[model samples]
Each structure stands twice: as structure tokens, then as C-alpha cells.
Target: MIIIYYKNRFISISESESSTLNSINIEFNKIHDINIEIYKFLANNNIKNLHLFGKNPEKILKKLKKSFNYVKAAGGVVVNENNEILFIKRRGKWDLPKGKKDKGESIQITAIREVSEECGIDPEFILLKNYIDSTWHIYDESTEFILKRTYWYTMKYVGNEELVPQADEDITQAKWFNLHKLEKPLNKTFLNIQYIIELFISQCK
Candidate 1:
């Protein structure tokens, strides 16, 4: 049993301990009978560990019938010559730079662009040797939805430019931290982000 909470309410779900639901579609007719708010309905019924989609309940039902899909892509993880990783402070949380991929851009270019836009340093050197795994979580700025995928790449900085955080993007500051001093904060990062760093370190060994 897992309880999904959204908008201050919980939805209870029971499944075989070893079974997981990857995606679920709740029709408006069925959802209207659940006695929960629309957002909570979607949140509670989402396929565990899979993408959740929430919009106007009626519209979502329509899209479900057609199998409409939603996906967003981003890139991140920046490192420097001193074996330090660059991080940004945003919304009072430490984070790596990442943003949506532009049309016509390759994922690698998206990685470089996001790093440069957020940190103001062009990578002088880069290697595309590994790919960090994917993660899913609800995004509810306007309507609840999921960020389907965020692609991560380990990058080495080669530029001589000074660092600048993209202020308008809500990034307050940017700086590099030596790995030895990064344990605590890195542990607090999203699990997938932490996994990427750990994988990179293990590969170096």
C-alpha cells in the first residue's frame, strides 16, 4: 500500500508487494465518483515510479483515449579542471544547471547550452562518456504534470571565463566545490543527481 498526497489530501492504493503500476489512466467518469479533487485523483492513481499527467479532468480523459504523450528533456552536470563540480544556488536549494532542449539541438548541445546559460562559462573541454539515469516527479506550477526525462552528462570545463549565474533564471549564485567538501550538500541533492556524481567518481577509480 502506498499513499499519494496532493493538495493536502491522500489517496490510498493497494497492490501486490512485488507489483508496480507504471502508468494509469483515470477516466473523468470514474474520477468524478472518487470523491477527491481532480488533482488529487490523478496524483493518487498515478502509476508508481512512472509519469503522472494532470490537467482538466475532462481534457485528460480525452487525451487518454488518444494516447497522447508528454515529454520534456533537460541536461546538466558540470565539472572543472580542478576536479570540482560547478553548482548553483537557486530558490535556496543547491542545484546543477539544466533546462529544456531547444528544437533542432542535439542533447549534447543542450547540455553545453544549459551549463553555459546558467553558469556563464563555455565548456573548454567535454566528454560524452556516460549517461545518468532518468527520474520522474510531479510538476504543478500551472497544472500538475511530469518532467518525463532529464538527460545528464558529465562535462569538463576548459574555458577561462569568470563564472556568472543566470540571474533571471532564479539562479542566485554559482561556484565550484572540491569533491572532498561536497559530501553533505551532494547528499541532499535529488537522488538521481547524487547517483550521477557517485557514478562519475566510481568511473574515475
Candidate 2:
């Protein structure tokens, strides 16, 4: 299942009906201009939830991808020996270390490189643990809409390298927050980032 967040609302793409009430269900493939329809739905403040369900959700997702400029990104949710989570401040919002996939670069490598470059950690010291999950979101850029799918991985930071935020990326701070005291950063993070951390915590339990 995929839940794309926009303006604090959500569009769920799955094989079954969403549990959310007041959801605007859509047979998105039949719509000639999926992108325009999505924009209209998003613009309507009354419509808080949107569901696109089908037997083959992958096909529906593929169809949706064709309607916009698609991008792939990968990132890490890194944990240190002190049981703290690594986070970065990007453009004043708390965000995990992530970036777009380079040409011909594997997603796993992209995750490692992004964490290394963004958080000033050595790629060798960032040990990839397991796949976490992926998230989808849409944003408008100039005249085109961009659909980004970010793959996430769980990682462990074994070294005590002095943290440095990537200034070129507008990351002002790179710090680790105690696992139990995450309220400060989580409150300032994007919905997708919160979802990733929640999903990761659920898996850990």
C-alpha cells in the first residue's frame, strides 16, 4: 500500500479499500488526465482522503507514474551506539539524510552515499541493516508536477565522527536525538519522515 501526503491530507493507493472514512475513492486509470484530476482533488479542502484501489496496484502506480515527472530517492534512518537517531535540519525542517539517485547508481548505494554526504559520516561506518519501507509524495515544480518515491533503509552508525551538516544542501544542523526523546524533532518533521520513523519503530517492536 502507498499513502502519498499533500497539504496534510493523503491519497492512498492500495489493493483494498482504505479504512479511512470520508475518503474520495477513484478509479484513476479510467481518467484521461490523472494529473489534473489529482490536482483538483488536492485543491478541494473538503476532500481530506483519497483512495485509489485496484486488483493490480502496481499497474495503477505505473499508470500514475506516467502522468508526472518521476524521481527515485533513497535515504537512511541511522541509529548510533547510544540508541539515538540521526537527523538533519534541511531548510529549517527536520529531515533524514536523503537525496536523488545518481545515474546508474543502485538505490542501496544511493542511501549510503546520501547519509555519508549529508551527515558527514563515512560510508564504511554506516552499516546498512535492512530495508525499512518506501514512501510516495508529489510536488509541483514550475509548470510540471514531480512524483518522488523514496526508498528507506535502516542503518547503524558505528563511528564517532564529528557530525557536520552539508551546508550546500541547506542542512543547518546534524545531530542525534535520544530515541526516547524524539518529540522535539518529530514535531518539526515532515509527515513522511514521521511515518518512516513510526513504521521503523513498529518493526522494531
Candidate 3:
């Protein structure tokens, strides 16, 4: 199954059905442009969710990729010895520190570099532990549709460092929240970030 988010809503593609009745379910067809179809679906305020299923979901995913400009990004879920999670506030919304991958830069390096640059932590102290997962989202930019795939990593901060949110990036705050007290902050973050955090927590359990 693959899920691509657009703002707070999402469209899921899978080989089997896994959605509620409120969702718009459709079988995949090669005749229609799937990416444009998704854009149209996102434009409708009434469509809360969508599910597309077929015998070959991989083929559907492949076709979906062709219609948009692709962008690669990387991020981290950083934890400290105190069991606190690092978070940043960007444009009034809570977010994980992430940025676009530079040309020829390895994805792992991009993750560490972004975390270090955004949160004022030294790259040497931010140790990437494991590849968590990736999230996809689509948006419009410069008269084109952009499909951004952000690779996420689980990282440990070995140093007790003060956070300095990258002000030029419109990051207002960089703070650590205890795992037990994350309800409010999670509520203010993007859906993709929320999903990543939940998936990470589930794996730990």
C-alpha cells in the first residue's frame, strides 16, 4: 500500500481495499492520468479521503510518478538521553526539521545536515540510527505539480545542546518535548509528520 498526502487529506493506493464508506473508492485504469485525477480529487472540499486499488498497485505508483516533477527530501526524528523528542515550529505549525536534498548528496547525509542546520545541533552529535520510513505529498509550485518524497531517519542526539531554530527558515522555535507530553504538539503538526511519529512510537512498543 502507498499513501500520498495533500494537506490534511490523503489518497491511498493498494492492491486491496482498506478504507471506510465515506471514502471515494475506485479501481485503477491505465487510460486516465492518475496524477491529474488526484489533483482534481484534492480540489474538492467534500472528498475527505480516496482509495484506489487494482491488481498491480506498483504499476499504478509508477504511472503516478510520471505526471509530476519529483523532489527528494530528508528529515530526522531526533531523541535525547532524557527521552525527549525534538520539534520545530515553522510558520506557526509544529514540524520536524527537514530540507531538500542537494544534488549528488546522499540521502543519509541530507537527513543529518538538515537536522543539524535547522536545530542548531552539531552534525557530529546527531547520530543517525536507522531508516524509519518515507512520506509523500503533492503540492503546486511555479505552475507545476510537485511530488515531494521525504526520507525519515531515527536519530539520537549525543550532546546536550541548546536549540537555535533557523530563523531565516521561518522556524520560530526549536524545543524538545517529552514522549509522554506530545499530544498538543502533535495536534499542530502536519499529517505526514504525525504519521511518522506514530509509526516510530508503534515500532518502539
Candidate 4:
């Protein structure tokens, strides 16, 4: 199954009938293409989510992107010596530090650079580790719909420097959380954000 998020709403692609009673369930097949009507149906109704059945979601997702622009991004689940995780509160929502890729940048460095920039941590203090996972989400940019594909990495924080949240970037605060305490902050976070963090933690365990 593939789940693509749009703000708090989601488009779930699976073979089973969706559990979302309020969802707009559409029957799809490999031979037929998803069209603007289905996309607009989700947008117009302020529906919480969509469930597509009887189709290969992997291929359908590729077709969905053709209707909008896509953005590439990278971020890190920064951890410290105590195994506490670094987190930022952006626009009152709990979030990890991340940003878009610059021209000619490697995905690995993009994760490191975004973490440092958004959290105001010195590059020398953070150690990059193996990649964690990737997540997909959709949002409507002013003129167009945007589908963001973010690469996530596991990073270790070895610095003594104080954490600084990038105010200019809309980050209001930055702090570390014990793995067990993650549930509190996560309650107010985006689904995709929670998904990435949990996915990383599961592997760490």
C-alpha cells in the first residue's frame, strides 16, 4: 500500500476497502488513468482522504504527478548522545529540520546542510549516519499543486553548542526529546512527519 499525504488529508492506495467512511473511494484499474475529476473531487469536498482500490498504486502515483510539479527535499532525524531526538516547532507544529536541494548538491549533504541551517547547529557537531527512508506528500502551491519527495537520514549530534531555531525560516523553537516522550509532540505533528520518525525509531529498536 502507498499513502500520499496532503496537509492532514491523504490519498491511500490499496487493495482493501478503505476504513475511512468519509473518504471518497474510487474504483481504479491499471488500464484506466486517474483524472482531474477524481483529484478535484478530493479538493472540492474538503474530504479528509481518498481511497483507491483495485489498481497498482505505484503506477498510478507516477501518473498523478504528471498533473503537477514535484519538489525534492532532504532532512534528518537528529539524535544526541543521550539518544534524545532533535526537533523543531515550526508554525506551532512539531517538525524536524529540512529544506530543498540546491543545484549540484548531493542528497546526503542536503540532509546535513538543512539540519544545520534550520536548527542552527554547527556542521562540525553533527555526524551523518545511514539514510532512514523517504516520504511523499502533496500540497497546493499558490499557482499549482506540489508533490514533495523528501529523503530522510539518521544523524548523531556530538556538539555542545546551544540549539537555535531558524526564526526566519518560520521555526519558533528547537529542542531534544527522549524517545519515549515523542508521543506528546507527535500528537500535533503532520502524519508524514510522524510516519518518518516512527519508521526510523522502529529500525533503531
Clashing pairs in 1: 124-158
Best by lDDT: 3
Which segments of candidate 1 are over 4 A away from where they belong?
1-69, 123-129
Show where candidate 4 strays beyond 4 Å.
Answer: 15-21, 30-35, 41-46
Question: What digit string (tens of lDDT, one per residue) describes model 2 on residues 1-205?
Answer: 8788774677788887776888977775566777777778767878888888878888878877887799999999999999999999987789899999999999999999999999988898999999999998877779877889999999999999999899998999999999889999999988899999999999889
In Å, residue 2's CA in model 4 sits off its true spot by 1.4
lDDT of candidate 3 over 14-133, digit per residue (tens): 988775757888788644767667777867867877888899988887787887798999999999999999999988899999999999999999999999999998999999998889
Q: What TM-score would you give candidate 2 relative to the actual structure?
A: 0.90
By TM-score, the best candidate is: 3
lDDT measured at residue 145 in model 2 versus the true structure, 0 to 100: 74
lDDT of 1 at 63: 39
lDDT of 1 by residue, 16-88 (tens): 2223345443434344434344344455644333222343534443333232134545666666678788888
Q: Which window of ten consecutive residues has the lowest lDDT sum in model 3?
A: 29-38
How are the candidates ranked when ordered by TM-score, highest leading?
3, 2, 4, 1
lDDT of 1 at 80: 68
What are the Cα lDDT values of the candidates?
0.59, 0.88, 0.89, 0.84
**C-alpha TM-scores of all predictions:** 0.64, 0.90, 0.93, 0.88
Clashes of each: 1, 0, 0, 0
Question: What tens digits encode model 4's per-residue C-alpha lDDT throughout 1-205?
Answer: 7788877878888776787767877766633547664477546657777777775667667777776687899999998989799999987899988889889999888999999999988998889998888988887668777788899999999988888899999899999999778987799899999999889989987
Candidate 2 global CA lDDT score: 0.88
